[model samples]
Target: MYKRAQYQIITERLKESRHFLQVVLGPRQVGKTTVIKQVVNDLMF
Candidate 1:
């Protein structure tokens, strides 16, 4: 399985205890949803 740089970045930020908005910016079809799903899955499970 391959993971993008954004995956690690997002995952790290999500682990933070502080509260803030994390906005992901990128062009279309760049697996934004995929990365988000991966982050959620790893953190939740």
Candidate 2:
């Protein structure tokens, strides 16, 4: 599967030792949920 650039960035941030708030901002109808779900699911297992 082809992942978006945002996916890599989000994944990297989440893998860090230090925690920080990551707010995803964008217009409506975008794949915000898709990216988030992909990231969470990938990290879950």
- Winning candidate number (TM-score): 2
TM-scores, in order shown? 0.85, 0.88
Across 5-45, the per-residue lDDT of candidate 1 in tens digits comes to 89998888877999679998889999998998888888888
Clash numbers, per candidate: 0, 0
lDDT, candidate 1, at 37: 86
Q: CA lDDT, every prediction?
A: 0.87, 0.90
Worst 10 residues of 1 by lDDT: 11-20
Candidate 2: residue 36 lDDT (0-100): 92
Tell how far residue 22 is off in model 1, in angstroms: 0.9
Clashes of 1: 0
Best by lDDT: 2
